[model samples]
Target: MRRPSLNDLAAFAAVANHRSFRRAADVMGVSRSALSHAIIGLEGKLGVRLFNRTTRSLSLTQAGATLLARLDPVLQDLDRALDTLSEERGTPSGTLRINANKSGARILLANVVPRFLDLYPDVELDLVSEGRLVDIVEQGFDAGVRLLEAVPQDMVAVKFGGDVRFLAVAAPSYLEGIVPPTTPDDLQAYRCIRQRLPSGKRYRWEFAKRGAEIAVDVPGNLTLDDNDLLVQAAADGRGIAYVPEPFAEPLLKTGQLVTILDDWCPPMPGLALYFPRSRHVASPLRAFIDLLKRWDGAR
Candidate 1:
């Protein structure tokens, strides 16, 4: 029996993860032919076909799948241990990838991230803003920020901000001479600014008062996916916009926006930072979480 080369095993893992020689090559920073040759050489030595290659696609054999299942975590642990060592040196330095729901990111930008960056200039932060929720572990993100209600209880959760909710608002000109609706059901009579969800359909405007929740499928002349644009349109007298409380706050303060159906807009939940428990907490992530926890306490 002979010991297999670590390089060959790494190539096998790369090919298995990417499911393509070209993509594996791109990730590993090698030529496609070189990556294919490495796989072929390993297969020849082991007397097993690790992948079933077709003209247009690649699929792993049973042996390849089993091998990948074992190597994936081993490689992940190796990387995590290396990052942990770097963090222990009194400098929180590493790439910290974060997936943030729109409002969550907004709050962080205003309140938290600047101070973190100022303290740890060595750390690199990759921030992605998205409307839909993403699985951070599967997507290779270090952490994610979402509404507390949106987070799964299994993950380690850190509350970051105070409770924030949505508010239905309209322009002064739009409400002038028009009776505002007292009940959520009454919104059907007025012009509504409809918002579309990321899933390619209109979002139902949700309202709650006295322990009863109602989702209103109202009519509208304008429809959009972005809350910012919808709020602007509503402020310009197009119709009522169902906007998150923080976004409408400054405008409401300045009398640029007027609230409607306030009682129906009850506070749901604020933001929470979450991550997988299995992975090692990188130093940058630890510091960021500490900062967030302190920020929450201060608020």
Candidate 2:
């Protein structure tokens, strides 16, 4: 067996990281045809199929997955080493990739993006909004933002946003002919707009009463992925929606929607920026963290 060149390995890793030849090529500053040929050449040498390419999607094979797992740490170390050298120049200059959910991304962008960019103009921020909990290290993301409850225990987490609460709300028209739900169990008789997570599971509505917490698997006629849409549907008299307070606040203020179970909704921990504990933090990430800390202190 022959070993692949470092360039070939890096090319393979980029393609695996993005799972799209076009995107990988863009990131590598190469043409799609050229990137494809490089992968083909690497596969010819290894004599293994690394990627399964279909018309609609590209996926990694078993060999590709194993190779990617091995390459992740090496690439991360290389990035950290390069970052260390860049630090000597007294400027953080590199692309920092971040994975976050829709709400988390919104919060981060609203609060820190402008200021962070102003503070460190040399740093590039690549933020991706994903609906599920992802393996940031394995996916080649420098860091991830998530609610404190969703952040993995293995990573170092820094609190950013403040406490958040859920709201059960509906349009006035939708509740005209119905009795409002007083408890979690009462939602069983109500038509709710359910939210589906990225993992394909319908989210259960949660509430707390007295000293006990309950999760209600409420039934619904309309199901969707986005929380904002769910809030809209409820405002349009479709049904009740369980959403974060911030997303539904506008509708509540406009008298389009009214809260039903505010007492049951308790404040929980808000957003946190998290990263792998095993890897050395890059200067770009450290600068962003410092900015976040300052913002938190001021707020």
Candidate 3:
């Protein structure tokens, strides 16, 4: 028997969490064989088989599951402690991981990220753009960016972007044979492009006017999970799309798309940055939030 190294434990945790040697290896930036060897060595030291493997799938053994349940939190705590120490040493430094949807990422790319990096060279930014609403604390993210309504009520929220409006738009070719929609209900008669959310439900187009809000589940032949793809479909004459103004701007300018039911659409709370209120904020993360507030004020 021998002492298990921290590297071996980390490798084991990654593999256990992902249940795929290939995926874990990719995350660790190491070869599959190297990760396998590390895990094998770790198992030998512990004198227990950590995983059951078949060609199609991998599952953790009881010992492995117990180890993972305990190890993950310890590693997370260790990482947080180290980050805290880094903050105390003069300037803010260490990785600041953010989880954001595509639109939120777009806002950060356009305004905050580049400038923040220049302002705090010691901070490392890890931005993950996805279509899911992640639990920032559970996922070990410094913060997450999401639409205002999507943010959890338990978290601290900050405005990150300007108020945004959804526009029902279509290419001229798609609208040629059809009467334009003058109201939200009129959308039901048109071939609308719809968005499929990460929660496995279709996103009903939302519109508001004069203290009234309307959600329309317009029928369409196409539905997609990606916002960019939905906008592209509209530009290509597939169908009319209900999308944020920013995504449809270029096409509007180029005359590839024309808006309908503009009077029905009103601005909603835009993208917001949020984090668990109970957690201690890292210096880099705090500084980033301050920067966002300053930018919000400036705009």
Give per-model TM-scores: 0.85, 0.82, 0.77
Worst 10 residues of 3 by lDDT: 133-142
* Model 2 residue 15 CA deviation in Å: 5.9
lDDT, candidate 2, 137-229, per-residue tens: 657688999889999999999987789999999999999977799888999999999999889999998898788999999988889999889
CA lDDT of each prediction against the hidden true structure: 0.86, 0.90, 0.87
Instruction: Evaluate model 1: give its TM-score.
Output: 0.85
After superposition, which runs of candidate 1 have C-alpha atoms over 4 Å from their true positions? 1-60
Report the candidate with higher lDDT, 2 versus 3.
2
Poorest 10 consecutive residues of model 2 by lDDT?
A: 133-142
Tell me the TM-score of model 3.
Answer: 0.77
Q: Write the per-residue lDDT of candidate 3 for residues 259-282, one digit (tens) a residue.
A: 988889888889899998866677
Off by over 4 Å in 3: 18-20, 52-59, 132-143, 152-157, 171-179, 196-202, 208-214, 220-239, 251-257, 275-284
Per-residue C-alpha lDDT of model 1 across residues 1-299, encoded as one tens digit per residue:
24568799898987886677876786567999999899999988878888999999899999888878988788778877877677677788868889998898998888889999998899988888999887676455789999898897678888778788899999999999989999988999999999988778899998888899999998888998888898889889999999898878888998989998899999887888899877678888998998888887887
The total number of steric clashes, by the backbone 3 Å criterion, in model 2 comes to: 0
**Backbone clashes in each candidate structure, one number apiece?**
0, 0, 0
> Candidate 2 — which pairs collide?
none
Leading candidate by lDDT: 2
Best by TM-score: 1
